[model samples]
Target: MASPLLRKPSLVHEGDATIVHQLLAQDTGLEYVGFKMIDLKVKARYEETLTDQECCIVALTGRITVSEGEHHFTGIGTRESVFEKKPTDSVFVSGGKQFLLEAVTNATVALCYAPSLQQLPTRWIKAGDVGVERRGKYQNQRMVHNILPDSDPSASSLLVVEVYTEGGHFSSYPPHKHDQDRLPEESFLEETYYHEVEPHTGFVFQRVYTDNRSLDETMSVEHRDVVLVPAGYHPVGVPDGYTSYYLNVMAGPKRIWKFHNDPDHEWILARQ
Candidate 1:
């Protein structure tokens, strides 16, 4: 759960992109997360100490140079990294604010600060490097992250990756809820969806609602439109005729996302 007082809100606007963030948590003492549109011609430097919380530094447009305690992580070409980066285990925390140097020609970067670190495993894989899996419908291709293997039930998560359909396909289909703390059933985690759409095109529909008489909300999202998964059966909907891409960042107390499927669509899980 997020602390209300620690919740800072803002709009991150750059050329051709806008990211709205509902910062549910922050570094132990820092109350505000950062959002900026920077330029390479001018070097940008930001420094802050982190509490127990973790932070995500995304190169919304170009590359960045990060210096942490006795280590430096270089992010090139619109790359991103968690402030407290974890290279192994798929789920772990470095737990610090650290410093960053952004030197992109013209770029917009989003910095997400949370109560703990949630960083994903990343490895560069070329096309044809591995056999592709046809796990989804529509034109969407599936390329599972090679770094993510089966983890312990007690582990924490950094990120989840999925390729969105080019023309109206579904990710997180059939609607499921991971808000409750259960044993091997569902785990509670807050998530962030970062998007990358095809040239001149954007995304469409995403629904978040509750089954226990809670109100539902449908949002028309575009590139970089971030939706908060706050205790509900949420589903991602891609409209017909446009290609989309996204990166999912998640973290919670349970450290696992155990879910209870809606009875209506429970059959889908069996197929997988």
Candidate 2:
């Protein structure tokens, strides 16, 4: 079964306002993998700049205009429908430089980055590009976003995927793990889950831990709750009432994210 690993939201102060950041993994004592999920409310006509970091933003609600110097990035406006995997208009700020932003309307955004400004090959995969598939006994249909390809043998350093789960369905059930880098089926890779629950209501459950030493944590993960996987098996499960959508951010020395499951439930793999 998948165990539980969760960290409380950390408060990050920027300008005169405040933003809540859910830190999933860090490169220091916390973990060499750097990851974070941030919720930002862009005030109308309120523009902010970023520097000394490489970042990506996903609009949660409302609309905003992102600018880099004279360059402009107009996001999909509200009431016009938001599309995933659309152009992520990106900006690079090396050595502590700031980038600029302005909100055409009140908006919330998610931003992610590495501390040293190390740029990972980033791409914007529209939700349209992901082929929806069913996994686990629940037969929950979900759209999986693959951030990295398996063709490059050297490219197995970090594997990232986002799953948009429909309401009233379950994913990551019959919990499994890849903590043992032993056989062809078992390869350990740290993982992270940044969830965006629809309607901003209800909760989801996520588990993580070693095979015999399972630990469970149930969090009311809403629009921006982040779950971390440091050194064990992790699986994310959503309840029946809410449509849970999450972005999985993973990074490790080995690029592959292979795993073994508790024999008790491993049989479910055959159905997939």
Candidate 3:
């Protein structure tokens, strides 16, 4: 069984405009990966110095000017909203550098991190450069956008991807788990799910469990919620009339993301 860990949206009025929500990390009981959401207004600036960890900044909405060392990216995102269904832009910077982002407009960004010493050159990933795939079928069908897939030679130990599911749909289906480092079957990876639901007020559901049913847990996931998957067969379901989106941040001893499906539910793949 798997015990799901969820963090609800931070309590802040619209007028207050939250700055950052630290979701998980070494200090917070997570060892490999860390996640956060950065919200800024026009001309607002945020800066951070990353040590011994590589980071990826994903724009959720609006545009921002990114400055890291001598590299600069202006207008980092073109999407007006997450529901735009358009591919968005993101930046990846190696550790031991300072990250500075100035909001060109009101914006929301996701920050993902993991330990690493290799200083890969920074890059601006265009929307079209991201590989996209329509996966599954029926209600389990979803779109997957690969950002920092393993094939990326510049990456050290981070794998980033985002999934979108239509309303009344299921994602991460068949209850897959990558808690073991056994190759050809599964490779251990620590992951974090940062969710954003269309309608903003709508919610989603997630089930994280293990084979023994000892750590089973189902959680009601609202907008801005973050779920930590230390080890489990995790799956998600979205309610009707509200689309679902989640950014996945992963890191592990091995950079590979091989996973194993629950044997009882693996047969569903044939139908898809």
Give the backbone clash total of model 3.
5
Writing each residue's lDDT as its tens digit, candidate 1 over 112-187 gives: 4444434322222222232224455433333333222125222133333334444567766677787777768777
Q: Where does model 3 exceed 4 Å of error?
A: 1-4, 11-17
What value does the lDDT take at residue 102 in candidate 1?
46
Query: Comparing candidate 1 with candidate 2, which one achieves the higher TM-score?
Result: 2
- Please tell me which predicted candidate would have the highest TM-score against the true structure: 3
Clashes per model (N, Cα, C within 3 A): 5, 20, 5
| Model 2 residue 166 lDDT score | 64
The list of candidate 2 runs beyond 4 A from truth reads 1-4, 8-17, 22-29, 41-55, 65-72, 76-98, 114-138, 147-159, 180-187, 214-223
Task: Give lDDT for model 1.
Answer: 0.47
Predicted candidate 2 versus true structure: per-residue lDDT over 100-168, tens digit per residue: 455555555555443333433323333344344444445545666443333322222434455766666
Worst 10 residues of 3 by lDDT: 11-20
Against the reference, the lDDT scores of all candidates come to 0.47, 0.51, 0.85
Which candidate ranks first by lDDT, i.e. highest?
3
Which residue pairs clash in candidate 3?
Answer: 1-210, 1-215, 2-209, 2-210, 2-215
